[model samples]
Target: MGDAPTQQVPGLGDVVGYLDSPTAVCGQRLSVHLSSTVGPTRVRLRALRIGDYQGRGSRLVWQSGAVTARQQHEVEPAGPDRVITERWPVATTIAVDVSWPPGMYLIEIAPLAGGQPSFIPLVVRTSGAHSPYLVVASDLTWLAYNRYGGRSLYFGPGSNHTQSVANRSYVASTDRPVDASGQRTVFKMTLPLVRFLARHGISYDITTDSSLDATPAQLVGQTTVLIDGHSEYWTKRMYDAAVQARDGGTNFAFLGANEIYWQGRIERDARERPTALTVYRQAGLDRLARADPATTTVQWRHAPLLRDPAALVGVGMSVVGVHGAYVVNTAPAWLLAGTNLHKGSVLDLAFGNEVDAQEPPGPHSPANLQVILHGTAMAAGRTKPSLVTAAYYNAPSGAGVFAAGTTYWLCELDSTCPGGPTPRATSGALEQITLNLLRAFAVPRAGRLHPSAATPYESPAWLAKRLPVGGAATGEGQ
Candidate 1:
């Protein structure tokens, strides 16, 4: 399996922390509460701007004098599947100012006492006028899987300290800190994608996950909306805003996979800000909360808001597994452009974690949805093959919707993928294709745009390429 891993060198520092707010607008003041083990130690705060240079990692945006480190938060037993985070007095709330451009910023916190640096993820959002694209961070998913105090929605507190912990926060708050090292995308998807956009000078804005509660309009005037990494947990408003954006002529590029597949509700604080996320992982949860639209929690395709993700993204979540090498299928030139990748091309080991397949072409699923990458997945005991499709479709409003169909899309762009088996050829192909999408989607075209007829469009060849030497199809859509 491919993994995005972190690297460390002597003298160079690394940071491990989370931001109070998942995101902040440019010029807006947001607090960054940093924590460290050593007391009375100076720390340097630097904002590293991600770029495209092969060896050039990032440029420094801002710096700060080292502040004394202290442990202010404590973890304690709360409930079965929760962790209560209590913030104490000792904290240096650094205010992010207007000078910071609207982009992803790596909040590097390095101890002057000589130790590996810690990293806190923060993104400065664009204010007022909309850019070409509105980038969203997968924060809700981050918190959902955060086993900070030893509990997560997946697993409750266990019997021992190593086994489990507990929490009472019925609705977990963003005010609580995330276990930075425990975060998967901060280094894997977020950093690499952000740097890619910056290096290519893509005109874009950014916003956090939960901010969809009060900032659905964040999509206004933007040509494209980009969602990166695992955006599995989504509130109703976030999903609606995306739909509204598509309907309103805003293009979308879901760089991540398994997006908006489940339903979640936002918990508000006294100020009406989203303080927590509530999810029960059952369709019944949404029925119980259907009376109040804000609290509805269920599979998006199940009840109440029975809007299918495949209809919006052109493909819905299906099997969970890996693709040895994503086979290129029928794709428009606007989609393939600079990438030499064409029909019959194989992106070596480019797919993993999870993937989606286009639903049977029908009213709900757009007929225009074209298979960009074709592959298959095996679910352990399943004898039949499940289709893996990276799809693309154009909305009537000239808004293009593309789903990467695999969770590993952005990670493939990460040149630092762990182990010696990095997909060098696959990475380059994905890079140019991403740039092509951004450039093409940013432009307003009359009617919907599709891949040129000059390009070959064949799914059979793709399937044939993926099929084993003498294997035959058990059945279609199996």
Candidate 2:
């Protein structure tokens, strides 16, 4: 919406590809499947650590120039009853080396002709004692909503763009490219935070949503686990592992909202790798539930399971989208360490459309969960006062769990929103809080997670907290 494109910077045509695996442990073999819009494509493949776009920028780590892609798009019908299947013959495979550090790496392939750059992302995981935090990507959620070729589970075939499902079945394949805009959570939500992490010299390992589903035990021995940006979908194993990690003293930080809200599982590719994410609409998922109850593919908090996400994340899904200022509800909370946000200071549009909250956290919820900050957004179409939340709770094992409770938490880090660029105070406030979070989390302790430490209230605190258009000197919303 600004002078530059917010995501999936497209060039001459579309250069697309997928990784052989969603993640790789250091010293393991990882493959990049490359394809292009033009024939016999020649491009430069460069690896960059996601960093501050508005400041230091994502820095290139390793690069190999003059790589060629020779694959052509191929389609095979899965039709005895299915619609279609799209596959690209392998163009080129790049073997990852042990020299690459453990972190989230974005492989950017740009045509020598200088066209739009296509990116393939993968987490370089490490189970060793070196790295402190594990940054997990929501690849499952990315694959869940990807509508590449117009065949997303939510939509019908590309030819029928009416948003109706009558024409297509409820399955999406990982064989296809990610939606043209790139993985929304990664590019827009997670990457910014990753960039923030890199800029600040935070040492962490990176893994994806699929990796968690495949082997959640990989979480053992980590100081903290970060599930940042739109981690809305999950497999039972992924959720359980994070819980187990928490129970075992591994801290869990949920930097974005709507995490673990849906239930889904992985379906293997032809090569027998778990590449596809399978989720059915409620009715379709109900049919599967009849066959195998454990594999039921539906919303987590509803029928058959009734497994509410709030139990793990400290908040549950309520509103899908809201646009408003984020008001500080707790001035004394340890999370607000450096920002100096008082009861009324606001972060302009810090809480985006989707947010999580207590529908009244039931008995199963963690007894120590505390409200960190309370906010209200510009409602899309609701009559009630909009409420967004930030939460924290500690486990007896010394592990602490945090929920930012809004998907827009990372998107606001750069002081830019869909409404246009916001005030510096907003960016400064959000960034400082995040820095405090990273610094606090890197330690083996949870900072300021106190159940009995909450203070008195400030009603409709938005009036006292908002940062005005030109940047305010009131030491409030920035």
Best by lDDT: 2
* Candidate 1 deviant stretches above 4 angstroms: 1-18, 38-42, 79-81, 159-170, 180-182, 283-290, 417-420, 445-447, 451-478
Candidate 2 displacement at residue 23 in angstroms = 1.7
Which residue runs does candidate 2 get wrong by more than 4 Å? 1-12, 52-56, 64-71, 74-85, 158-162, 165-169, 269-272, 283-287, 416-419, 445-478
Q: What is the C-alpha lDDT profile of model 1 across 1-478, one tens digit per residue?
A: 1111233211123333455566666555555665555444567766765554454666677777767656555557455435455454434565667667677666677777677776656767667656677778777777676555545555555676445433223345555555532255565556667767766776667777877657888776667778886788787778788888788888878886788877777777676756667776654533457567544676788766678888788778866654445778775677788788778787776665576776764567777777788676565566666666787877777778888887767767755432224478888888888888887877553126653221223333355445431122221110
lDDT of 1: 0.64
Predicted structure 2: clash tally: 13
Q: Relative to the true structure, how large is the alpha-carbon lDDT of every model?
A: 0.64, 0.65
Scored against the true structure, residue 127 in model 1 reaches a CA lDDT of 71
TM-score each candidate. Answer: 0.84, 0.85
Task: Give the deviation of candidate 2 from the true structure as CA RMSD.
Answer: 5.3
